[model samples]
Target: MAKKWDLFEGYLKCDPNIKAAEVVTDYVENYRSQAISEEVQPIIDRLEKAKADYFNSLFDLYEKEAEYMRIDRKVKDIAGVNYYIKPVVDFSDINLINEPEIVGAQVLTTRLFPTAVKREKYSYEEGAKA
Candidate 1:
């Protein structure tokens, strides 16, 4: 089955530095500030409702999943389960507003390098030859 596209994916692609919560806030604020025509207002309203429903469901799922994990961990710990063992319930790929930013300074640090060199080692003639 094809994967469902996430709403934050587009925003993150545009600006990787933005947090998921910021994307939702910006989207809602932008939608509210827009002046829609009478003919298209109903469609816009329906779209807004749909987006709200989608986000609400996602948030609900996130909360439940988190609670389940916490309970599962506690139960396992009480039962003397091995620390290296994985959780029984694997609920991966759930996107939440509280998730960390998509991009970080580490990403840039990997691609960039220092260009400076000591003046004593720097030679104008050698540099020109290269």
Candidate 2:
């Protein structure tokens, strides 16, 4: 799956006027700002805790309820991105954990596109005169 950064890179490549390095730097900075913001920090913490609890419960044979609790938790990414976390089942022969699925991420591209240029239209006579 193509990431948001990859899309930004492609956008920069399509527009010769845009500097790739500058745009990438700005994008990274924007991501960092959002990651550190108060609104997103708690979500990050909760995900970390969930992952830890899930693993700890998985090792302990009697912690089935805890494992289920971890699975029930809906952990979203910092930018409100939702990715699938495969639930580990107790079945030995059956492998329920599949490949990591990347759902989607919210991209902030307010300044990515350049301003539209006005084009002049001319009739056949106007073109002939020109």
Which of the numbered candidates is closest to the native, going by highest TM-score?
1
Q: Lowest summed lDDT over 10 consecutive residues: which window, candidate 2? A: 98-107
Error of 2 at 61 (Å): 3.0
lDDT of each: 0.54, 0.49
lDDT of 2: 0.49
Name the best candidate (by lDDT): 1
Per-candidate alpha-carbon RMSD to the true structure: 22.2, 22.1
Q: What would the per-residue lDDT of candidate 1 be over residues 7-125, giving only the tens digit for each residue?
A: 45676587667677876785576533442432246456655986799789877876776868877777778878455545544545443333222243333445432233222332233
TM-score of each: 0.31, 0.27
lDDT (Cα, tens digit) per residue for candidate 2, span 2-55? 124553666657966667686678668774565455335654675598678866
Q: Candidate 2: where are CA atoms >4 Å away? A: 1-35, 62-97, 101-130
